[model samples]
Target: MPISDDIKLGHAERLLAQLRESYLQDLPNHCGEIENLVLSFDRKDPETVFDEIFRHVHSIKGSAGTHGLHLISGICHHFEDHLKTLDGRFEKIDGRFINVCLAYIDCIRTAVSLFEKGGETLPLENELEQLRKRFLKNNLAGLLVSSSNYITMLCQQTMGDLPVKLTTVDDGFAALERLLQQKYDFIITDKELKQLNGVALTLAVRASDSVNRDTNIIMLTSKMSIDFPAGLAPDEILPKNTGLSHALVDAVGKIFNGK
Candidate 1:
């Protein structure tokens, strides 16, 4: 590499390191605020206090992601998911729930400490994710199969606000396995896929007597249309175009309404 280019790269790296150091310095203050909010449930209005707690955690997660602290970001992400499971029911906000929230706060503190020490943080991130899944166990389950991050983000933006717990996979065969082994309220897949395409997977589900045989399925395709074999068609086949987000919203709405 050119000497000038190498110098520029080193300068950028140094700037980034300084920025990360600054964020780490302030992280404890963020964690402490969340801990206080969680413990203030009895003294303050529960809804307002919980909202403040969520906002602090969310800010930390975003900042951590921007600084490339993915483990901290992921732990905070799972913590946010656990908070969502409450659905804003102040009545359900009890001592045990406060303890759980504090535990998440403590997890964030531990992750920050380990990060400073250059220790592994994956195990902590995974444990928090598992705890989140357990809390969401009773929520509506939905599976999405697509290799496109664009599609995944779009789906999350449109459908994520709902009370549904989404599981994502990029392969058709893997999606089929999940369908057979577990029940899902809905399935979304790209028409073109590896191992088995969406058409084949949809056919398998409809042909089976499994619990998800009658579940709603939404198929996304780049093409305008597809000719499905008779007696086997997904609940909705949407074209992946400018109107995809709207179509997805409408399709999901119809599914909820049993259309």
Candidate 2:
């Protein structure tokens, strides 16, 4: 006798629900650790930082697979390949390269968030392809510039000719302060900065006014581990090594739709 398809569908839904809950409970902490590693990259000893970053990437690759985020997992796997090439060598981390990596993280975080919200499609494939191209380039600044352009293009695509105000802050603290004084629908930041760092800044904002408490926060970083503070929960955390334009656009859509 053929089994009932209805029963099978119900079972699948239950299993997916269980996995979603588990991921929600554990993802924040894992991402926080990665943020810490990203922030410490400039200040820590080169050998230690390299090992920490490598481990962070490896962990993300493993966890993403467990959560069924195959695109994110694949991206992490490719990034790990690059990191492994520099294992034991004391190479100075390039700022441009770091920026590109952060963009990728932002994309993954946004995509995962959308999935959790019942979104049926992912939007950042083109940006990811562009990032893969930049990954082959040795010039760090060029990569950063390319990513910036990609982000701008993404915003235009999602919003349809609407201009988004773009401002660069020196660090997370400044960015947080600016956010508090304004009515921004969304805020994006790197995990590491000269002051406060992204996680701390997020915590500070959430603890402030009631209106800002639920504001969307997206963090970008190249670190692999995710270890954020308890009170400083961000809406999303992205790995610095992926293309994030689609993720950014999706976040904007959610905000505009009042989700």
Give each model's whole-structure lDDT.
0.80, 0.59
Among the numbered candidates, top TM-score falls to 1
- How many angstroms is residue 50 displaced in model 1 relative to the true structure, after the best TM-score fit? 1.9
Q: Would you give me the overall lDDT of model 1?
A: 0.80
Number of clashes in every candidate structure?
0, 21
Tell me the tens digit of each residue's lDDT in model 1 across 114-188.
878988866875666456556566556678988788888898888877767877888888677556645567999
Which stretches of candidate 1 lie above 4 Å from their native place?
A: 1-3, 137-259
- The numbered model that scores best in lDDT is 1
Clashes of 2: 21
Instruction: Write down the lDDT that model 2 would get.
Output: 0.59
lDDT of 2 by residue, 116-191 (tens): 7867443555565566556544221110111244443543454443234333455655455445433344667666
- How close is each model in CA RMSD to the real structure? 10.8, 19.0
